[model samples]
Target: MGTIWTPKLNSYSGAKYLRLAQAAADAINQKELLANTKLPPQRRLADALGVTVGTVTRAYAVLEQRGYVYAKVGAGTFVRAEESEFKNKQINFATCQPPLTNQISVLSDAMSQLAKSPQRLTQLMAYHGEPLKEHQLIFSQWLHKRGITQQPEQIVFTHGAQQGIFAVLNGLMQAGDTLLCEGNCYPGIHTAAVQLGINIEPITLSDEGLDLSELEQKIIAHQPKVLYITPNNQNPTCIQYNLSQRQAILALTKKYNLVILEDDVNYCLSSEWHSPIWSIEQGSEQSEDPGHVIYLSSLSKVFCGGLRQGFLLVPNLYALKIKQAIHSQCWMISPLNTELACRVIQNPEFMGQREQVIAQRQQLCIEMGQRLGLKQRWRGLNGWLQLALPLKAHHVVTALAQKNILVRNGDDFNNHQNFIRLSIGDAADDKIFVQQLAIIEACIKSLSQTAYSVV
Candidate 1:
């Protein structure tokens, strides 16, 4: 066939193969070449374009990843038949959820085992809604491995961590009560607080987690009933508290008579140093009391999101109140789901899979930073990018969405500044992720250029 589209290489677009792919896409969409057209084989294409077979192979991969073309097993590649439909399918990089396949496999195996014993399966299906001491014991043992010390009586089950958050907010704080959180708090926390008619003030964050001075001032002024916080791999920013920062916060808690609701949902992905703040407080030399921090954890992120199993490591004094509130709201979490979660935790491969996923995520962060010419390496599922361009966060996010890529604006996480949160776990694999980053890098450069011209 006649030359379909001439490949163009430009410095701003990064790799030569990537630029070639983009050039072909532009030409095809612009009607320079017809959709559903056939393309030359890799060897022929390399010869025609004066490049190596490897270059052509890689270029084809990029095109495939971008949904521009597809290859049959025996035939050459052809333009995708449904171009418009493919473009509309979004690549979501906003929400953070664990990979489903492996978790599903694990859960399936556990379910099969449970099915063998009809007696236990029937018992799990029954609505024994009240807090079950046996279920709590299983969950408590799981948490014990993570450095948290708790007993069956001190544990309360909820639908998930969000419900645990709601339960804590409902049971501890009255209507119109004030609560304190980091400047960029989780959106779920914000929504829960608003619906409950509880006032929440954001404490300014410093290089070291929460600004101690600002937190003290807020505590004095608002006398917040509880300080809800995510200490390790914090949502949106992935900010982990340092030793000194944790110590400082503990000291202030005593002075202000504060109740800390520690959201340790991301604790599984957290490193050894990123211990739960509750654990820190207990081990601290300055801490005299153990009941000040209310601990919360969930299997949603670690095991499977569909299970919706979560636990609250309530202080002995507040256990009854929290349990009462939980009973009124959801009665009991699905004992079936809770049992599945417990089995997954007990599985020998649980820790191995968790570490593997987290490591992959961290590597993705490094690769993204490198592609974007950034020096920072963010941890966990999300990486926060503080944009320097003279554009709104929403505008940047919209531009990405137009490219069929989705990411969260920092403001959605209560950040007042212009920033983007890229969910590192969004991409299914490495090649897809690399293509997504190339698209993002090109988009940002184009927008920055436009902004400069406007100025």
Candidate 2:
């Protein structure tokens, strides 16, 4: 199994894993690896390639997650049945998701710590108000940790950032009222707007962020009721907006009588961050309307998505309305996730682990993408390269699914199938994950047509 290659780092390059994974996938796609084809033992591949068993394990995990490959506990990993999608269509690259952190210890610790006080859990088992004081503190601390002190009272709780979004769009604008979003935008918000019968207007975007001149023109002409932005960590494209551009955006928010719905859902995973929209010191509140801006963020990006916890910061003026809308449905967020979140926030070790986990996943994501010769049509978390898909994001996503890997394509965030995303930190061990990446490369090679290309 001494599959030695040239250069030391070459063994670990993101391209290496990409190529290897693609090779494995191609073997299956070409039917060279038959239905239920059991993958070679991890040690065998590791020894064969003169690589660590961990690497092999990662590659296998990648394959398994993509649905192209699978493994039973004591049994060996194998390819799915030929009738399965992995055997059907090619792979899609348009999905965007961060790696899952398998922190059994963390979960166990949280459970144990919370178990000591079952009373707290029991107390919160019932419904709480829309603005849960507990969650607000957690959210405020989260923002403050990032150097933002925009007040907890200004924050309202929501099911997820998605719900916060619904409130922002719902509370600020009326049906038939126009709004502006990134030319390339978060599709979730786009869908919500369409569902509510609100008009969505797109503003052209640059790598730095939205084009200020164009944004200004749109604001001045249409005088949109609201401006939706993902400033801290822009999504789908995953670009970080620059300081100048962000400041300019704040200026426009004031000038045009515009309501700013800063949809900052991705702030948690952002490798790089911008000052929050609220922190921008436009003018004194007594002198002007700082109430024009609204901020939304979530715990889902940092913790489990099932946490079902998100927050909104509005000018005290709109807090009541937003809370009222939240009240009508789901009444208030489930107190269970809230108290658990509070417990998580109180745990000092949690923050340290979060940093470590994000960095590790970021590194893995970079290496995986690089080994495959994946190029960013744009950038990503922590200054990493984000590749633009060469096919319709949905097609690439579905294709990847056929391989057994679950991913979020651009269409999840945008109606357009143009962009696709891949994350290194998602799900995989070293070697097996590399193997899975190799499958993606194969899919890219064999799969064609809907090329959205790059910026």
Candidate 3:
């Protein structure tokens, strides 16, 4: 450990220094500082900071209560190490990635088969320029399973859904143009929008979907060029829109002439598919122009992140613009990754593997809900748990980090609600999954008790 974090008392905006202490602990929690480190003793820290031991003691207590640090009978309290912090070991529910065992096994088999055919191996090395026609056809056929149909000409291959998002937004909107989305939308969208100098306005959310009243208000207020939506099993909240909700949003968008950027990247993992805004617009023959929706999706979540293969279903009207954007970026996704994706999607056994994966995720969700005494709020690979936290989410996240359990706090997604996203991608087995949840539960109970005692 370099040294116990000592906040510069005069610099912090608050007099209490509690937030400063919390910020120090959060830095440690996020691995900005090394883990398994030692914090200064209360008396020693007080002396250095020119503060009383009581203030330092209170701060330390808060840290301990929040699971950022722990005391021993003889040894000094220490910043928790990530790897060996918790008794049960670490569970990685932070990142959204599918369990790799089955994918690896399947890929290995596929690769071995591919290696045998010299002609195919040579084809993978050749560069098929922008809008790889054969690959587009293959993707269109695969996407048909999810009720998405498009001409090969309409598809643009991207490195991943993230890149596709950036490309489409960059192509459609100019600098300073406003983009509308759910208040707590995917971080990736926020990141892309910011990079392109596009302003984002958040619409209120409800159980059904975006609050139409608030959405229309924002639409009128912002005059946004595009609306990004994760209609099926939305990120962070895992809330899906029903038919009425979809129609309401479509109606508003149509009224405003706003382009709908539908990001259904995780649609493949969903148990049941909800009709996308693209489909709604496509089926509406009464509209003079039905090309209002831009669909973006990928196999990263369902297939393999390493493949980094995403496809875009651009509206026929915007095809040229999106293709220009795609060409400006990378010209094309690697032919190799596309081939891998094509092979995986074509494999008959892959569906069974997907079913098995979904089963595992559902089982974990059910168990977590039962243990926490909440209805399981999971769809596809990710689940959301709204925590009744005694402390702020930062403290809770830090506490969990100390325990070797990684989870995304709702605040990370611009969601002020006390929620944590539990992705089934990292928990490889059921026993470990349950054990991890038990740790989280205990931590919550412990924090709640501390809060009570303090009161």
Taking the tens digit of each residue's C-alpha lDDT, what string does model 3 give over 85-189?
Answer: 344656787888776434554575578778898898897788777655777888888777767756777788889999999888888899999999887989999
Candidate 3 Cα errors over 4 Å, as ranges: 1-89, 267-270, 374-376, 389-391, 452-455
Candidate 3 root-mean-square deviation in Å: 17.1
**Predicted model with the maximum lDDT:** 3
Which of the numbered candidates is closest to the native, going by highest TM-score? 1
TM-score of 1: 0.77
Report the lDDT tens digits of candidate 1 across residue range 350-441.
64344565577667666756765643426566677776656567877998887889999987877867788877555544455666777877
The whole-model lDDT of each prediction reads 0.73, 0.65, 0.74
* Better-scoring candidate (lDDT), 2 or 3: 3
| TM-score of every model versus the real structure | 0.77, 0.70, 0.76
Model 3 scores a TM of 0.76
lDDT of 2 by residue, 1-455 (tens): 22222223343324343445556766677777777767788777666678777556655665665567878888888878846654444322333333443333345456777788878767777666755676677768877887776777887778888988887777667889887998767778878898778988898878789988888888877879888988877776766778888778877777777778887776344446666777775234543547778877776656556666777778887887787777766677777766666766666545333445456645655665566566553333222233354544556567678677756655555436355665544443344455666776666555553344221
Q: Give the TM-score of candidate 2.
A: 0.70
The regions of model 2 sitting more than 4 angstroms off are 1-97, 102-104, 130-135, 267-271, 282-289, 351-399, 406-418, 445-455
Full-model lDDT, candidate 2: 0.65
Q: Model 1 off-target regions past 4 Å? A: 1-88, 267-273, 284-289, 351-354, 374-377, 452-455
